[model samples]
Target: MPSTWTTTPVTAGLVHGALELEHTANGILPHRLPARARAQNTDGQLAMAESQPSGVRLVFRTRATAVELDTLPTKRIYVGAPPRPDGLYDLLVDGHPAGQAVATGGNTLTIDMSTGTVEHGTGPVATLRFTGLSGEDKTVEIWLPHNETTELVALRTDAPVEPAPASGRRTWLHHGSSISHGSDAASPTGTWPARAAALGGVDLVNLGFGGSALLDPFVARAIRDTPADLISVKIGINLVNADLMRLRAFAPAVHGFLDTVRDGHPTTPLLVVSPILCPLHEDTPGPTAYDFSHLAEGRLLFTATGDPEERAAGKLTLGVIRDELRRIVTRRAADDPNLHQLDGRDLYGEPDHAELPLPDRLHPDAATHRRIGERFAAHAFTAGGPFGDGTG
Candidate 1:
């Protein structure tokens, strides 16, 4: 006997962790930022990063033994660098890792890092199929690639799939830089925030955008509007990465962003996290540049360009940002007891770095991501922690 297949239309209920869905010519495009927030910005990097679907997944319940999905992914290419591997899709059955696959032959975006120019190339859709699932009724989750911009074209399985029921867990909203956006992580669930969410027994809404976690007002508004029991903002890195602002503007910008978030979530458990240890930017200011000197060796690294003496002129550095964040949190916590601060070093400090040094002198590797996620779970979800209720 042959197996029968059923096609399911992708809807909002089936998509988790994305703020909005866009109807495209081929299929649906998931957007991390809502339409209003996306419309208010003109930065191409932000647009690309948000559409990458860092924490987005297609979740449902089914008894299907075989599943197939059609997607058109916009793969990224960097000029004068080694080609990047295809983005990976992680499959989880009944909350455990089951299988993984990658879709090929989609769109392409060729970028020139030095000149800031992007060229687009269109390609054909790719179908990803996964077979050999248990036939018993179980929940299924297809985690989209954390670093690829994918347009879901279709979903087909041997059996019907319906929206999975609520897990009765608290919702956690996290925002951060590329590290939190799953940069260099092996898969979508391998991102620190995703792993931490699982260990903490919470649902996650990740707004981690690569190279775009600056304290932007629109992002604050997006967080203000989203509903979450626990909220955290990982700050400091992108600021130094872009060398976007000075100390005079940085303080006020931080305050304003938090003020906006408080407008809607006054009593939410808010955690402000400083940057993790990045030796190059710990003391030196950035406008971080690629160390193309190793390009011939098929490796790319980052180096700090701004002088350390510029700190005296109020240029921002990781150390300076951490001190300022502590002061701001202490003063604010005096009145708002719900507000808290966590040092990023506690999550990935000097010792951890020494043991598992960053591969590119910037972003942590997959192993380091797991370590950071485990440490974060221990710190934030355990007893006596901000969001914890003094119980495991």
Candidate 2:
């Protein structure tokens, strides 16, 4: 029997997040930032992560057993370095994990960082299909890759598709580093934020950028302007890793970031979380160094190279940043009762580390992402937590 296929435009209404959408020559590129936010900085790290579609997902409804999506992903490759991991798209049917896929068609951007050179080549587009659905009207969610930039081309289903109705759940707007960006996670939906959203029953807008979460003013403004019932900002690591600021500058920057967000969400429940335990960086300062010794073996790892003595000279460390953040939130909460703080250690601490070690000496593994997400839900989204309902 022949079936009619309906094509959907992949518009903003069908997407859960992405601060802005760019109409690329081939398709629509979902950006984690708006034009104004994007215009402020032209840094390479920001550009890459902003377009990775970390927390972005395609959500819709249809009574079709089969569906297809076309995408043009811009996968990055570093010359003479470990191969880049493939981007994954996780599909959920009626809120349950149903399938997974990777886009095959796209262009490749190669960079020779050792010499500061680059090249680009075109590739074919990929058509991802999902079948065996029950044909009853159902909600479908396709989570895009968190590490690769993708341009959505088209969405086709056996039956007509429409924007899924809002789930009526509270909106959770979260910002953090790569770990929160789903780094090293097996699938997009397996990212900690995605898992937490599932457990908390909230709509998620992830602004997690791999190495770009340095307290940028533009990022604060983006968060300021976004509408969210609950908000969280995972601070520390990036600043330390980049060696961007000193203890003197860190405090004011933290205040400024919070100030920008408070400008818009004055009364919304806001949570500030510090960095989890990273043994190598606990007391050591960083402009961390890459452990390239295993690069030839097709493995990548990171290590701290900064001196621990630098702390006396105002260098920042995860340990120092954590204490400062807790102090900042506590002082602010004195007057603003809605403000709160959570020790990220509680999510991925020494005990958890004993059982599940960090593979890269940084980002959590798939199982840890799940454990952290579940812990976050219990601590921050369950009854009596900051995002808790009024009943508790």
Candidate 3:
């Protein structure tokens, strides 16, 4: 006779790195942003990004030889773009990579990038099973897909389970754009922020919303209220690509954001990172658009549509944003010693770009993600760095 499976309720205590949990019709959906912050905005992009659960995971301890998870994933589909693979669920045992699985059935979110139109199609839940595990008590983590919105339906194991005890690691809360949201990275743990967190021996709370990190007031408030031992904000790329603010508005907005974060965490080690090297937007302004030129070939690429000549008029570009960010951090750091600034180029600069270019002319590929993660760990977590040892 087969061993009877024990079903466990997925609850808040069993989940890690999520700020909120919403009870859906089928199951629980983890959210990176709290309900209050989400209530303030109605942008579809932000909504989808937050629901994706970039750095969220299920954590427990058990002696089960086999484990199973039932999930309903809302997969994204671009009408004309190449087909995307099914979302991945990564399993870790005792802090080591154990296995990886993909849930089969789920809803589909069809997006027409050209017209900014979206359509939804419903599907059934998928049960992902992993067997052959060691039957000794050990910590287990099931990292949710970084790019897909997943509703965790149920968890089943051959043995009873309990929430894993705290690891006592420092919590690092990070906010950034799609790149930090694991846009092109292979898995949730593969995101640069995730990789860096692992290398730095810290817990991660990622607030990286794709194409939506516009320094919104609600986001700042969300950051302000969240508890974190270390904090970092990656700004500039989205601001430039979205063409959201001018130089005059940009400086004040950044200051206000930092001010909001400091409201809750006055002495936290906070690092302000500029955008990494993006040659397309380095000199040219944006309102980036899809290059439909190769649509016939099933290739979708992004291109800057803003006129380079608009720089004189104060249209934002990567170059312009970087300069202003350095100046702002310099002046602010004089009065606030805990605050620090790092050039985005230092992470993935001109030399790094020549080696590993962004796949879509905007987002970095998986290899570049690793490189950026390694470099970030070296910079921010080492001695003399903002979040380094001996720093408050």
**Residue 113 error, candidate 3, Å:** 1.8
lDDT of 3: 0.92
User: Each model's TM-score?
Assistant: 0.98, 0.97, 0.98
Q: Which residue segments of model 3 deviate by more than 4 Å?
A: 390-392
Spell out the clash pairs found in candidate 1: none
Q: Which stretches of candidate 2 lie over 4 Å from their true place?
A: 1-3, 390-392
Superposing all C-alpha atoms, what RMSD in Å does each candidate have to the true structure?
A: 1.1, 1.5, 1.4
Q: What is the overall TM-score of model 3 with all chains considered together?
A: 0.98
* Tens digit of per-residue lDDT, candidate 3, span 1-392: 13799999999989999999999999999998999998998898999999998989999999999998999999889987889988888999998999999988799999998788999999999999999999999999999999999999999999999999989889999999999999999888899999999889889999999999999999999999999999999999999878998888999999999999999999999999999999899989999888888878877789999988999999999999999999999999999999988898888988988998787899988888888898898999988888888432
lDDT of 1 at 312: 95
Clashing pairs in 2: 105-124
Which rank order by lDDT, best down to worst?
Answer: 1, 3, 2
lDDT of 2: 0.90
Candidate 1 or 2, higher lDDT? 1
